[model samples]
Target chain A: MNILEIKDLHVSVGGEQILKGLNLSVEQGSVHAIMGPNGSGKSTLANVLAGKPGYVIDRGEIHFDGDLLNDVDPEVRARAGLFLAFQYPVEIPGVSNMEFLKAAVDSLAAARGGEQTTAVEFVKSVRKIATALDLNPEFLKRGVNEGFSGGERKRNEILQLLLLNPRLAVLDETDSGLDIDAMQTVADGINRFRDAHNCVLLITHYQRLLNHVVPDVVHVLSDGVIVKSGEKDLAVTLEERGYAWLTD
Target chain B: MADRLEDSFAESLIANLDSSSGSWLAVEEIIDRLKSSLTPAATKESWKYTPLRDFLVGFTGAAAVTPDITGVNQPGLTMSALSAAGEYARGPAALANTGPLPLADAALLCAGDAVHIKVSGEIAQPLEISYGEGVQVPIVITLEDNASLQLIERNNAVEFCNHSLFVELNRGSRLNHARSALDSNCCDWGLTQVRLLETTDYRLQQYHTGARKRRAETLILLDGRGARAELTGAYVVESNSHLDQQFIVEHRSPDTFSRQTFHGIGAGKGTIVFNGRIHIHPDSPGSDASLVNKNLALHPEATINTKPELEIYTDDVKCAHGATVGQLAEDSIFYLRSRGLSRDDARTLLCRAFLKSCIEGVLAEEVTEALLRNLTGP
Candidate 1:
């Protein structure tokens, strides 16, 4: 089944058009990769999908799980099973990582008519994911992403994706700052969340991430529109030849 | 205009003096000191940030006696509240109390509640005091040898008002005092004074909001060996309100340490001012002190004035003070907004984080929760 559909979407920032007329679709349980040169509106697409303000949507329609997403809030979209792993996660001083994750989990669960998890249950459930991501248990006690190393921040985002278990996870440059080991850990976590009920949208500029977590479909975004679409081999071809062919 | 207001207020204070009791003599002495020590319109360096002229204009009436809080029930306590008391007693309560100084405010002498508490060499219970509208209160607490006490005072004012407090700590004694002022619109003036003795330790935390016009003053005198003091405060001003805080710390003996930090956030057309000074006397060798003031402006028209000063006569002391005024970080706000949080929620979250650092050490969970709820709103 189609989990998300974006058609003829135009986005502007500070009154300058970025996403001219983007189009994409993803089926449940599939992984879609979007790659292009710099300024191809990759991050802008992720942000607009998450309902970030200032990205004036001049025209288009975004359908997520059969609902029009133009007016829905980011939190509502998140609760409806959409997640965006920020390229640069914010550091929230004085707010412990544990408290933030708990709030996020509870908010999503409550939206789905699930009972709130107790403190003990939450700790237990989160520990497994934390261990899988090779994150220290003590990291949970520290403030959200405050003073974290580049690799540690990437791992933290993956940890959230694992815990929240969103239906359509948008990984926006999640591997941009990660080292080799950190990238593997993040890819492993994403694979664990990839099941029959959900899908993944991997947004990036490099193909290194695709080596560990292969995409079922790859789309090249240029000038706000998908200029090319093919199977996983397309990423490898683009990584070798670059976007020279797309201009022709 | 400033002289007119000062003269009129001073005159009203003298005219309303009750000539019957010894307390009235103390009130008169305070008025005399105010007239002599303060040059009505002198524009002294210390009063630069505050509009003393405007404040004096509203102080024309006689200092009214705060009604007795005989029927009000004491607010309940929490574990965090108790812990704050314990921390204060163990750290700053080992100094001496040399009685009331002569030049201090005399209204403090007459109206202050002086409680003689024996801390049993440790803090036993968390102390809580609640104040409502039209209440002008003064309190003095002395901690005995090796005794410690955690004192929490919550101030809620409803109408045009004034609230005053005076505290003195003795040697080998410790005092942890936390105050929250949530009702600020009812009053035109508010003041707080604190003094610590030799080897005495004092810790004070104040949270204020919702005032149309408010002013807070804290004065600390470190006179004994190994005396130490810490003062931390946070305030949120909204609408067309105004808030000000003035702090002075004097190190009179050797081996004294003091630290002060004040944080403020202003929205709408609100204005905030913070003036802090640390003075190290010639005899106060080996003294260590620091003061930091930071303000966050959330609206285009909001205004903030922060001044941090250090006056040192002793060359061997370590002292530093600084101030900063700016709006919320654009990157931080954008990051939160990208997470699907509305702009309002994102701003609220960041503001709460900024204020939490000042009051996180509070021992009363209930008070902390109550404060967070008030700041974040429903």
Candidate 2:
């Protein structure tokens, strides 16, 4: 069964159409990669799926776990087991990363009729994740993404995904700012979070990430719609051909 | 209302005066100054932004009535007294009062008498003071020679009250004063004067919330060489309240430095005013000072008036001032809301962040918590 389905999705910003009649679907326990060049609506698709404001949805029907997803808020979508690892996470000065993550986790848990985690319990869980991501305990004390290196920020995003344990994770260019070692670490984290009940939509422009955590399906998005869909080989083909054949 | 208030004020003033007392002489001097230098129609540049006329009209009277202090809450410091006792012991005794200042209009002849704090050496203890309601109570704090102390003062009253604080800092001393006003019923007016000896340093952080009418004025004299002063203030005014802060820092000696930053958030029909002035004498070479005023109008009818002035006489000195008034950043709000916080929650979060710098400077944790609770409303 499809866990998420987007049909005829069209989006616009400031009267400029971006996504036009995009169609895609993903089943549970699968990893999907959407590869496209810059301004090919890859990031726009991620943002629109996450329900970010200011994007005019002219024609679309998005179903997440069999429920209409367009009208819900980004936060509500998060509570409903959807997570977005932003391409460029914002730095919130004076708000510690630990405090923010705990609040987000507690808010989601509360919505799911689960008891809020105690600080001690949260610290224990966070320490484990931080260790896995090669993050120091001191990093949690610092303000959210403030003064953090680009690699550290990407690791922090994975840390949130690990702690929140959402059913569907949409990563927008998570590997964009990572070094080779950091890229391996991020891929490792993605692989660790994969399970039969969960899915991931990895949005990227490079095929380097696909080499590590191979995608179950690769889709090419151009001009707001998915022009081609195939297994992992398509990414290599696009990487080698460089969209020259596809345009022709 | 003005005539009745003036008449009542005169009667109360007379009732509090002891014709033969030496302490009463200061009261007379203040009154004389008010009459001559600060008249009902006085055009003091500092009072231009505020409706001084309306505040004076409501001044009504200054009475000597003993107030009830049983329910007055004391401001708590971030550090524990036991942990800070050694530091506290060596601090300026006159500035170390840990409890709330005696309520204005309270009988301060006995236990409530002003404590003299003399800072003579280096001390790390942070002192906190809270104020309660009523008409006439005086706190006299004196800082002396090469002394250093961090003092946090909080004014939180549940009912109408009037309070006055008189402070003097002498030569080479360092004083960090932090104050917070968090109650709605408080109609408070505070005047602080600091005199710096050679190379003395002073910093002030003031914050207020939920006041009917509140005004705070700070006057600093950089009398000795190398004296420096820094002032930072923020306020969140709601309802129909009016809040104003006026500051004057005079560079009387060469090599003096001073800077001021004031911010405010006005909602509902509330009004806020910030007037900051820096004066550098003709002979005060190597003097540097600047003032910045920023405000956020959270409502259409809310008003904010900011005037930052610099009077520089020495060509060698650097001085500048700037002011900005606008609403909260829309992108910040959207960012928070995107994180799952409701719009109201997002606004509160950003507001808290805006005021956090001032609140954190307050070394006392309990006082900070109380102020945050009050400003954020429950």
Candidate 3:
């Protein structure tokens, strides 16, 4: 079943159009990889999906789990099982990571009318995810992403993705600034998070991340819209041949 | 005409004190300065941000009420009234430099009899002093060598209050001072002056919720070598409220260290001003001092002014100072929202986080909770 369906989406920021006439679909239980060069509107698409302010959806129809996503509040979209792992995670100096996570979890659970997770269970789950991502459990005590390295920020985003357990995950260039080992760890986390009930939308610039978490479908985004769609092999082809061939 | 008005007000205050307690000789010099130099604050660099002259133009001084004191019954501590401890309370009011404002001296002169607390040893229990409505009282505290005390000062629903606090920390003494000015819809002027002797330590934790017209001034003198002082404060200004905080930390002895960190948030149409100044005397070589003032403007109409001033006469000292006025980061708000928090919740979280630096400790917990509870939507 299609978890997300976008038709004729046009997005603009500050009156300058970025994503023009974009259409895509991601099926449940599948991972879709989006590859593009700089200024290809990849991040714009990710932000648009998250309903970030200043990103005007000029014209589009975004359906997430059979609900219209246009003009929907970000928190509303989040509570509806959508999550975005930021490319550059924000550094909040005084709000501890543990506190932020608890608030997020409680908010989501309350919106879903589910029982709030107890403190012990929440801490255990967070520790488990942090350990799996090679993150020090002590990081939870520190401010959100405060003084974290580039690789550690990406790992922290993945930890959020796993902990939030949203139905559809959008990873925006989460592998841009990672070493081989960190990338492998993040990839393992993404692989572990993928199941038959949910789906993943992986946005990236290089095909290296695809080698670890191979996507079922690869889409090449150029100028504003997705210009090519194929199997996982297409990511390697684009990486070798360069985006010039497709853009030209 | 304004000068005459100011002088008349000063004379009235002096007369009031003279009738009750005839010890005007101790603070006569300060009163003389107050009469001569009560000019319009607009031209004065220190008082420019605050319109003290305007606030005083229509101001009729309030009645005096004694502060409620507690926890002083412990051993090694002595409490007395300023009238009885005549010569003992003289030195603090007559200190060489009391900044450019005469507000402290006025508070001293107007207060019929102040509170005097003396500590001779480590007082395990904390002393709490609470000010009632329309109270203008000056407090004097002296800690002997190797003595330590935790002093907490609180203002309770004060309509109009003037407070002046003086402390002398002797050699190797330690003072942990916590203050809360949480009354709203009132006019308040407060002054806190402290002198630390050799090897003495002083720590201040202050929390304030803004009032209709409020100005708080703090002066710290690190007078002896190896003396240390740390001052931290947080304030939240609501709609139409005004808060002006002026602080000066003077390193008069070599090897003295001082740190000041304060954070304030302006919610709605209020005004918040912070002036942090650090002075290092030429003889105070090896002085290490730093001041940080951060302000958050929660509403578009809120006004915030922050300035960090540093004066170093010696070239061998380390001094760092910074001031910032900004709104919450939009990206951070969006990040929180993306994590399932509503816009309001996200803003509250960021604000609480911003104030966390200055609002953490057992002493600050109650006032902090109260301030957060009374936080109005921006």
Best by TM-score: 3
Tens digit of lDDT per residue, candidate 3, span B47-95?
6667665445323444355678899899999988766333433354344
True contacts kept of each: 0.41, 0.24, 0.84
lDDT of each: 0.71, 0.70, 0.85
lDDT of 2 by residue, B139-172 (tens): 4455677767777776766555455555556777
Residue B327, model 2, lDDT = 84
True contacts kept of 3: 0.84
Clashing pairs in 3: none
What digit string (tens of lDDT, one per residue) describes model 1 on residues B1-378?
Answer: 546645455556456544232332234445554665445333555456455544443332334355333212223211111111211211222121111121123333333332222334565556666555542434334466656767777666566545555555667778887877776464545555555677888898887774666767677778788988999878777766777777778888999999998777876677787888787889889999999888888878878888787788988899999899888876666555444455676677677777777764464354454444544443
Worst lDDT window (10 residues) for model 2 chain B? B77-86
Model 3 agreement with the true structure over A1-248: per-residue lDDT tens digits: 99999999999999999999999999999999999889999999999999999999989899999999999999999999999999989999999999999999999999999999999999999999999999999999999999999999999999999999999999999999999999999999999999999999999999999999999999999989999999999998998899999867
Question: CA lDDT of B356 in candidate 2?
Answer: 64
- lDDT by residue (A86-199, candidate 1, tens digit) is 898878887778877776777777788999899999999888889999999889999989899988888988989888888999999998988888889999999988998999
Q: Give TM-scores for every candidate, taking all chains together and pairing residue i with residue i.
A: 0.84, 0.82, 0.94
Candidate of highest lDDT:
3
Positional deviation of B364 in candidate 2, in angstroms?
4.5
* Candidate 2 lDDT by residue in tens digits, A1-248: 78899999999988999999999999999999999988889988888887888887898899999999989887788888888888888787767777777777877888789999999999999999999999898888888788999999899989988998988899999999799999999999999998999999999989999999899999999888888999999999999998657666
